[model samples]
Target chain A: MNRRDGDTCSSTPDDSLAREERRLGWTLVAPALGVVLLVAIAPLAWTVWESFHHHDLRMPWLGRSFVGLANYRELLGTPRFWASLAHTAFFAVASVSLELILGLVLALAMQRASRGRALIRATVLVPWALPTVVAALLWRFLFQSDAGVVNAVLIAAGVLDQPVVWLAGTVTAWVPVILADVWKTTPFVALLLLAGLQGIDPTLHESAAIDGAGRWRVLTRITLPLLRPAILVALVFRTLDAIRVFDLIYVLTGGGPGTATEPVALYTFSALMQNLRFGYGAALSVTIFAVAFLLAVIYVRLLGADDGRGGSTT
Target chain B: MDSLAAACRASFLLLVLGACGGGRADPRPVVTISGSAVGDEGAILRRQMDRFMELHPAVRVELRQTPDDASQRHQLYVQWLVARAEDPDVLQLDVVWTPEFAAAGWLSPLDRFAPEAAAFFPATIEANRWDGSLYAMPWFVDVGLLYRRTDLVPEAPVSLEMLPALARAAMAGAGAPGGPPPPAAGWVWQGARYEGLVTVYLEILTAHGGRIMDDSGRVVVDDPPGVDALTFMRDAIRRGVSPREVLTWHEEETRFAFQNGDAVFMRNWPYAAALLADSVRSQVAGRVGVSTIPAARGSGGRPASALGGAQLAINAHSDVPDLAWLLVSFLTAPEQMLERAEAVGQLPPRPALYDDARLAAALPLGVRVAREAVASAVPRPVTPLWSELSERLQIALHSALAGQVEPGPALHTAAADMNALLERSGLRYGMNAP
Candidate 1:
């Protein structure tokens, strides 16, 4: 803000005109700033404040009192909290990586398609159009042990003699969760990448082909380098979403077979809503916000550096 | 534009004033009771509320609908009570929640009303008392029962060891020539990781002479008996007596499996008996039998049933405590309970009603079976930390049953966590104080 003001002052010799412009800018942006403060900053501030207190709705006799960082201390000490954080990181990395890979393949395929391009793109978005909870429930039904279609097909194909209880095992439970997430969100990532793919100059690919470059060589050298920004965008979006996942896993496995698939957001919800431990829940919320913010900042930095390099290369 | 904005603001103020004026026009004392109001439950509650309004013409009784799901309803009630809303004067509490609510000071003590506590079953009344005072009135009782196919088993198992054996034999005998198709599994219960799972574990634990907490409120769920109980449950699945799929089954799923003649033995609540007796929907309609869950052989444990039911209590923040008590007393009255039993198959809390011939005709399982089950009913530990404690136990039980961890280690972890929770909340002292 200071540099922008300095530039305005230096560019314009008239001091009063610059002052008037600054005032007008403030006036024009006041409402939006007020809304951000009200909706975002205020709740975030309140949650941070709450995290330092001791408040349990179920135990009213304990009374609401400021306890410094006692809630945070307890949260950090909790094995479940650490496990949930690990689960969230694992889920975010696994699901987001799968989505990115599958999405890139879909985007490339869509770009190569000549006939019925619009129809193909629209039809590919069918899974993305379905609600997350609905999609998760569909996957759950398909994976059910006794009568699910997954088991039926597997048995028919001589894959197994008996149906496997997917949700009953710790490792097996994550299959449906990650698959549901990827199924529901890969189209979104593909759409983003497809936009980036379209923006790449056709001349670049044409020149590379005239030079006897193979399709794979052209993709690696030109298409992929240009798709960096879009991939980063998809990664940031999917990672943030996967980190805060609740309803999909909630509907499918309920974070169970013993909280084996529980994410930090689900644990925070259990603390806040189910157990009514507002103070500790607020601490969990603040921690998740910090992690997401840190990741976003890192991604934005990478995007900025990539933009600068792309400008020079072009 | 200024004039239009002024006009809208003026009309909004008038609307608010009009609403307040309308509320003031009703001079009668309004009492709202919130509980399940879905389908038949809704119809029965409406009828009862209408009768209540008729008896007390000067007051208005309103039926506010709450979520039918217990956990959702519990969260809603906590939010409401924490905010101290006065409209919902009466609350229908689960038996396990009475202590939690009372300890939180969200429920008004009912001792002042001089309720005939002796008239109800001792265990039912005991569950509602907190700190030597009655806080709620037992409305109806729900006890877990061992449901077996009478045609397959011929008689109830005398011991827990014999139950799975009988189930295995029944499964082998089910597909005889010209008989019913082969049963899929031996036994089924609510093994899902939730409150239902805890109740199921409690029945098994008690049957093996284990208690979650001793009388003095010390955590004893990791004792030898508890280990034996969990091992028995785990081994049943391992031996194929109970299906591995039960790990995902809740009450309804188990009921569906048993009602379809897929299982020879099932464990469930009294509510299932009514649905199971419907020949159109149930494959083994006339062949079902109810018995108390049997004790483990040589464990010196008695046949036990996990106690569960609903209780009526006055909201502590209510404006009309006396009127709320009146409604509570009325609903828990013997006649009303019997009516509820006949209409919905909810077992009356009053032991005296078991002798009534009408209950036998009304309840599909008959009064004798219900009486025996209720007689053996053991309440989950009465503590304000019951929800949290039960959650931990559910995880442990589910982990062991799912083969994620051994029963001993899982239960030990649960006990340690629960004890720490109790200590941190300072409820241990409150619970153990003489």
Candidate 2:
């Protein structure tokens, strides 16, 4: 960065500036490392350590006794934990699958609509831009059994003879949460895909059209392949988010009607906050961090390892 | 390598904290008391603190505004007490938590602070005493009471059997006048699967010859009477007396329901009456009246109400011990009892405060209904595991309210889980063993 340091820092010029620059190189990266150490490494270590200890919320400040793998044993043994894991899996997988397909379709439709794409794009972001709690409350009101508009509309149309407890019963509760999540986040995916779509050259599409490459073939061979990186990015972003979902589930269902919609976040929260089992909660937290961390590493490696030269057609 | 550095850092922090602690020889000593910032709290806090300051020239009472929900406030207090923060010297404890908090050694035992604790109401005093030590002083008394429209519903709901039919007829148009009845009203209360639901249920359960746990800690409520109590709750909704949607309601939602003039009757605490009255924001302003949950015939017991108020305790770590005790005394004494009660619609913790005619008028039913409720109130179990018990009760009540399982099975399941928790906590009772 110094004037005398220039490009030959391995053998610096005999100037004070070059010597100072060489001395400051490591110092420049120190702040970033300090931040990472404080925020991530320390807490991550504490969480891992706490997972092996017996801690409860009532005596939150006391020294935790190391209990080896007992907390993890209990977590794995819990029917509640397994059921919640299944519920979270279903939520993330089903919701993300739907969003990806819908987002891709929307991006394709908007790609060629050259007129007013900006306005249309802005309109799509409205759902994504809403605060989560506000979105949840709006959905909860509309989905209420008695006063909710969805039930009222359904009942009026005779689709339901009796009012269904949208947020009450377990099987029925996830529908609204999934619907809310998909509605709020799919536009985000669409916008990303739309950007990717815009980045693709127009002449290739025009040539494909002139050569009688049909719409499906052009999409399959050219657009979809080229958009793979964008799709992977969106998937990575959303999957991580959907795994740790708390606010919506807490506000809407509160992990209720017999723990049907309970996810790991709600599970760990009850352990920590409600049950006052801080050590056990720590175990759950560590487990989730490990699983999610593993998933992130897997995706980054799998996707990053693939060459940018992926399949595409003109 | 890091251990020596960490020790240095710790000593440095201690020196900094110690120096800061010493520099504060300020004449004004601050004492914090937790109270809701609702109703007339703004005026009442100013007047009471002014009196407190005048009485003790060195003391300054800082009112820590607590949320209306006692449970949430209890949570905050738990965090403070666990961390042993010096501020918030006076803890306003939920009546049930007084025992649990006392047992945990978080509160300064009050015999050392106020030796005149014997003058407190027997029940209120008993509630504050844990293992022969009074760890807290009473701030106010609260009991869950039934609120009904006086003009429309019958003046006295004599028995539990008559309430559903009466609520329905009045709501469905059978010459009910004061209650929000006749096609416009709904029956409202805490129906969400939480502590409130269990509290409401216990009010009816005890009235119906039911018991949750026997003197020995054995499960006693898994019988016909318990089912009847739960069935009555269901009947209220199925019979169109209370709305089915009440299952999702908490205090605020129910308050909104009754205050907005949509409910014929609401079961709540004494604080609700003040809110209903000239918050003429409240629709059923003049129509509301407080009474006991209806008693059941041949139930062996009188109507039961759940105790739901706070007690002031000195945080054991507080440096201004005398100031904290003085603040508690000033707030709960007979002279300022009305000021505190009228400031907020809390029932006076001191039974003697009920004797004041002026104070009685401000609270309306403070002297009468509250006194009756206090006379036969039930406190939640005083075990250290009360937190766990409360959570289990919420789940059981939720299951019952959602129609997931019949009430009897749910209570049985809850009792089993509770027994396990109690066993886990190393609490042994002779009679609790089958």
TM-score winner:
1
> How far is B319's C-alpha from truth in model 1 (Å)?
3.3
Best model number under DockQ: 1
lDDT of 2 at B373: 82
True-structure lDDT of candidate 2: 0.76
Candidate 2 residues A1-314, lDDT tens each?
35663557554455666578877986998999999999999998988888898876444334467899999998898767898888888889988999999999988888868799889989989999998866887888888876789998999999999888777676788889999999999999998998888888889899999999999999998888778888888889889998998888877777776566889998888777666677799899998888788889988876776543453322
lDDT tens readout by residue for model 1, B1-434: 22223335445534643664454566889888988666677788888888998999988887766666688678778878889888589999999999888888899998888999989999998898887888999988999999999888879999999998999888877364697787989999989888988888888888888889876677888999999999999999999999999999888889999999899999999999999999999998998999999998888788999999999999999999999888888888888888888888999999999999888889999888899999889998888778888888988999899998999999999999988898888775445132
The true-versus-predicted C-alpha distance at residue A169 of model 2, in Å, is: 3.2
Write model 1 residue lDDT over A1-314, tens digit each, in one string: 24455576455556667889899999999999999999999999999999999988778789999999999899999989999999999999999999999999999999999999999999999999997766877898899999899989999999999999999999999998999998899999999999999999899999999999998999899999989999999988988888899989888898889989889998998888877789999999999999999999999999999999988885
* Regions more than 4 Å wrong, model 2: A1-31, A57-63, A115-123, A144-165, A305-314, B1-27, B174-181, B184-186, B218-224, B428-434
Candidate 1: docking tier: acceptable
Which ranges of candidate 1 are over 4 A from the true structure?
Answer: A1-13, B1-28, B174-176, B428-434
Best by lDDT: 1
